[model samples]
Target: MHLLHDRGRPLPAPVPVPRDAAGARRLAAVYAPPPDRVHVRAMMNTTVDGAVSGADGISGSLRNPDDSFAFGVLRALADVILVGARTVREEDYRRPQGRADLLEPSRRPGGGPRPALAILTRTGLLPRTIEPDWPTYLLVPRASREAVVAAGIVPADQVLAADAPADAVARLAEMGHRAIQAEGGPGALGQLVAAGVVDELCFSLTHRTVGGSSSRVLDGPAHEQDWHLASLIVGERATLTRYTRA
Candidate 1:
């Protein structure tokens, strides 16, 4: 990875990213959350033409090496990973493994709890193969919690019913989760944005263009908001950009 632009200003030259433990610590520092309050940042990928997925209906085909590295870094920095039910089913979501190793010891004091996986669902439907041992939470509406419990999709203890996205975020914050990273499926991203809860967005723009009717990084009603470019790193295969809410 190399720095291409910072705050919309072009860099005179690209800086090569180190590939070692020190490098990981440096990259993690770039995205570290503030100590005061919870911050919700979303990580997403899209083709040059704005399509988030390929014809096969999955975003994995659009990912490159740089994107993968950035994704891992984001996960390592987060206290919890948030995703939608649709993404869980389509992506064949599995419990994240060995993520603790990715975290720098200083970032997590005395080997803190590993990042947990939190799924947003209105219907409470999840794949049967979801690991029982994984630390998971289902954020749903209060009205749906009983139905979800009756359906037995997940244990009652793991289910968290919130009135809306803002409420869910607040609840997570109250539980000491200050670094929340939402790996979204469009609808969920849209909801988070609508709730005015997103503080930053890390988008990996693939070099190729996939012109199709696939969903964009955000779906649903139009939301007009301003964000300032924080940094833009150009990789051999793609460009990773970070935008902070302005």
Candidate 2:
């Protein structure tokens, strides 16, 4: 089934042009994807100096109002949002309010066909604090079935028996989710990339120097496949680079 929203008007003018490397990065973030297509974007915000966060020496926390708006637009455009348990636990994730806050209202009528939330975990470690009624799923390894059942995460037929991330995507597809976005914790992204399932990547580069040799975009050794640059958006404090699997 088709998963993208229909557009009747011409696409909005692109977000602004960047004056420097940093600004270019921001512009890249906003214009990275075409308005059409059942695409999946991976979002990450880094420091001007290339850090994901400053807390505990991590550098991902470089947020500006413009960047937030751009992200809001991206989320509004998505059909499903998937993240790792570690991302939610460390990132203070709130249940999506609805599509109105995003870019599409009809899609979010009663608060959404709000992108269904999917959490990746092998042992059912997803927190119990999340709303039970929320359209959420905890994808666990088959060996963890009993543990997940015990934890009360409904063991839906969409279980990914293998721990491979690509298999998980296939299972989600079989269950009828055609388009999927992955919000990652590196390891998960690596597995997805290794499995060869990622369609597009939206990388946000912050303008501040967060000097740390810690983690990076893709966790493991680089894959041999080529990824083409699809688009670019530059924000005031961050640059977003879009890449699609070639």
Candidate 3:
């Protein structure tokens, strides 16, 4: 991988992204959140034509080795990962296996080796594949709170009462979570964008295009926000760009 830009400035020479253990540490450092405050970073992979998925109809098909590496790096660096319920189901989301050495021991109130998974859903029903155990939290409205609790999917404390996407984010912050990473489905991403909670967008573009009905990275109504490219890199037959809200 080669970096094309850093801090939004054009780099005269490309920088290589290493593949060894030291390389992994470097990659995590590239994604570390600001130490002073919580940062909400949203990441997604898409086709060249803006479709969020490849011809195979999944985001995985649009990724290459380098993109996969960056994905893991982000998960390893985050304090908690916020993802849509639909995305969790579609992506067959599993408990994050964070690199023990890369995890921040100071970000979250409770120090855990891996980033916890926070699932956003208004419905009380959860995917059968999902196990509501420790390190897993559900974001749902108060209306669905009883049903979710009654279903015995997770502990009552793990079921957060929230009516909107912004509410969910606020609740996460209250729990002492910083460096939040939202691996999204467009709908969920859209809501967060609309809520004005998204601080940065880590977008990866594939080398190919798929002419389909796949949604864009953000699927909400008209809501414009200024963004500036924080960094850009090329590798794995894809372009990885980080855009920060301005």
Candidate 2 per-residue C-alpha lDDT over 1-246 given as tens digits, one digit per residue, 9 for 90 to 100: 010111222235554453443443443334434434344567666665555666564333566654564555556545557777787677755564322433334232123456667778767665557765766767778788666767665545433454677667766655556557776777677667767778877776766665667467567546777877756555566665667788
TM-score of each: 0.91, 0.75, 0.93
**Ordered list by TM-score, greatest first:** 3, 1, 2
Q: Which wins on lDDT, candidate 1 or candidate 2? A: 1
Cα distance off (Å), candidate 2, residue 179? 2.1
For candidate 1, lDDT tens digit of each residue in 1-246? 777666556778876665455656666766666656788999999988998997788999988877877777667777778899999999887664323457546353213457778889999878987775777888899999898888776688878888889988977776667888888999999989877899999898999887879987888567788998988887778788888898
Please report, as a residue range, the 10-residue window in candidate 2 with the lowest summed lDDT.
1-10
List candidate 3 segments past 4 Å from native: 99-101, 104-111
Cα deviation of 220 in candidate 1 (Å)? Answer: 2.2
Cα lDDT computed for each candidate against the true fold = 0.79, 0.59, 0.81
Tens digits of per-residue lDDT for model 3, 92-145: 877875565566553332355678889998885567877766478899988988
